[model samples]
Target: MESKMVIRQSIGFPRLVKWPRRVGYAAALWSLIFGALGLYWVLGGDGFPFGENDPRGQMMGSYLANLSVHVGGTMIALTGFLGIFAALAMVRKWNQKRLYFLLLFYAWVMCAILLFIIPDSRILQNVAYLFMFYFDLIDWIVIHQVFCMIGGVLWGTTALAYYRISRDACGNCGRAGEGASIISASKWGKVFTYCAVLTALPYGIVRFAWAIGIPLGTENIAIIGDFSGEAILGGLCFGGAILTLALIQKWGEVFPRWCLFIAGKRIPIWLVVIPATSVSVIIFLTGLKVSPQVVMMIINGEITMKNWGEMVPTLSWLPWGLSLGIATIAYYLRRRSRCKHCGKF
Candidate 1:
């Protein structure tokens, strides 16, 4: 009887914990550590993670690469210090509407800079290379950028928690005194879902054509020197495009009958959300890095109307990422079961 009671208590513990508080504390702790690192750099520490201190920082085109140590370090340290206060305020559920909005703006802007602006295509390229059994491409810089992204995610989570808490909503699920269920939001979800799918087609189609030696957009067949890499990347794009459709499809919620095993079983929500969200961030970062260069090239007349196809597809990544993210959230909202923490569906 005692052992059974202990097991039951252990099982119930997770559901009873206040996740918002925990997430807020985690955000504060991350800010503290990051701030300490900045201070260390300001004090002449050996291995600063940004700008010229990073070996590949220039190649990655990190905006921080140009700043001197003192300037960058001070900025980082200040942001970290401010982040701590922001995180703590969210944790405490501070109810001042004006102050909360200010913090929300700050948090989201920081999140966008960290997650979208700061990172370049190198991170995604490195991951792709790794999957292709090319290990040398994975380096410390990539890991550092990943660390930055983690921090961004934490801040975003803190902002979200604060948003819900301020509105007196269930922190776990964001359900409040509402007129309709989250499933009702699926209408907009489908719109974004299809938008994401359409954006993927251009890149995928061009790559596929190049792989088949067609040179659909470029001038000459020689321009498409090698097709193997193009083929692999094109396949990946198509695969991603297909998987994205699952966001609005019935298969996303349950296993299909075609599967030999686990058919009809409910799919784990995080299983889909985590990968989708990560890919969306990566695509957005890649587009953010490339879009400026592409625009400059167009302005300089280096890339003209005749060759628009080559560069135009790259521009689609930003919107594609954003749409996919919204679609994923919509999928989650539509499929989420009753909240275990707040007892709200």
Candidate 2:
């Protein structure tokens, strides 16, 4: 009877790592290695990290003395360096959940901000220019995206792990509210959801066009057919938009009977939050990375309406990224404040 009671009250979250401290040590090593590379990028040859033969290296010459690359490199190096401490804290078994969360979140935000600020031509005009030349300059853009994307996955999954390890410390310390006093649905939440859906429309439409064989660029139709890979990502964006709608709907608060044994149970806060937040991080990193370059091209009169039409879906990424972040954060706060037991945060 006591065990049944405990099960009813417990959140049922699973442990991601059998040894958190060991994994933390591994993460620390990984972050340190990246930090070292970032250091090289700043202090290495001709201020471009790679040689003049690199695409990022080539782009450096267009600017006034590679100033932007230096600043971006320094910023990345700093974040990567600081990240080691966060991972190390976990290794030391720090009881401060907020401290760990803050450190990891800061790393994610700094990397995302730097990605948007750097203005790499590889993400020029809002679409990731992946297959342009294949190899020579590929590392420039590939590293930038891979770094940010990896950080997003790392920090997000780390957060979920923390929640499972220490639910109370990680913001699940909440209980039932007064009978007449309940948290109301937020209007801002609805607004952000609508915004995400709206912004996502352009991208979905473009992908649908491509899938149906509409050629938007100089790439041959069959060559474009090879771009079926992009269609999957676009589908994910649309899926995210649909899921965002749930944040503002009735289904988000309660489970339907479809959920087998857990039917009609109050939805687990972590379940919804972890996935939504993870997707938001990914979209923000991807979409915002192209914003500075897009704006610069427009300001310099290099992008006309005709050219913009070629990548119409990408234009929506900026707004979509921002709205997704806002919506996810709002959802998290609302859920955390209403955990079924222990009304403390």
Candidate 3:
């Protein structure tokens, strides 16, 4: 009740955001398409996408390669099946209450699983890369991640919209507080926002120093890959932290004076929502390596928890993911005018 009350008290105005119906439709359409392809592959007699006596298998090693080929395939097929209902739930007019609720529930559950439980198991495969190879389009691990990325965006955003429309209509309400900040999140949202910003800076600074040939941790530069790549990716992460401010600041709603093309114009909500929502998934995927992975290794006696050097830095993934996700949801709610159930300001 306090949570509900907080939402009601937070919004004292009658402004509304223009929900991106077109994006929702596109996601829905793709969900069905991707889901069908997945179902076909799963049911088909063909072997999994990777694995077997393939040259590509050599890149990721035996354990991780086989895992992706087998376990990842199963996950892909399951995600594809859910994608069908997820697409259908995007409809505001869908009459079947149970199905509608179920779809929303499934999307949220899958997102959590993707974000927390079975995080993109690409770390072992990535052990080969000196720098992050996540954006590499050709890698099989990257390919599987790409599917998860797309599905997460569609599932996460569609569920966000559903809850925005009808409070009781869907069990998955996207974020912590309902009737939350569609423009800017609540107090918790701000906390997470700052947390993300602060955590991102360390990586950016470290990478920048490394890029400039300033030896901080290593004496030999030969060990590092294109320092420029680290600098660039790190910069992107750092820059993303700045973008999170848009959730709390007016500049997010209006153009910063820098872009003369559309200065002071209201930035399209989709522009922020789409990227922010998608990044949240990646944040979790990356964070998983630190938290659960380390714990599992310790549990299995692969490593000792006492020598926790990378642990602290790695834990940043959780806050980054949480803050980004919360802030985006808050931004959506803050800007949107109508409530799902009340249908009133």
Q: State which candidate, 2 or 3, has the greater TM-score.
A: 3
Pick the winner on lDDT between candidates 2 and 3: 3
lDDT of 2: 0.56
Residue 253, model 1, lDDT: 75
**Candidate 2's error at 325, in angstroms?**
1.5
TM-score per candidate: 0.86, 0.58, 0.63
Candidate 2 lDDT over residue span 1-345, tens digit each: 432443454545433224343555655666786677678878863434333334443433222224455675686588778878876665443467677667556645644444443333343323323423334444544465456555545544444444444443322332223322224436677788899889877776666556666655324455245456557645766776787887876678677788789877667556787777655654565555555566677798877754553444566877787787788766766654433333333
Candidate 3 lDDT tens digits, 50-133: 556234543322233445444555666667666665666565646677876886788787656544444353532343243455
Model 1 segments more than 4 A misplaced:
1-17, 53-61, 95-99, 179-183, 219-227, 305-310
lDDT of 1 by residue, 1-345 (tens): 432333343354574347777787888898898888789989998776666766666555566666688987888899988889888877866657789899888888878877976667788788667656777866666776787899899889888888888888888778885424565668999999999999888888888888887777678666474577777777777889999999988898777998768897667777799999999889878877777778888899978767876877888888888899888888877766655556564
Could you give me the TM-score of model 3 versus the true structure?
Answer: 0.63
Query: Looking at model 1, which ten-residue stretch has the lowest summed lDDT?
Result: 1-10
Order of models, best lDDT first: 1, 3, 2
Evaluate residue 313 in candidate 3 and report its C-alpha lDDT on the 0 to 100 scale.
Answer: 46
Model 1 pairs whose backbones collide: 51-65
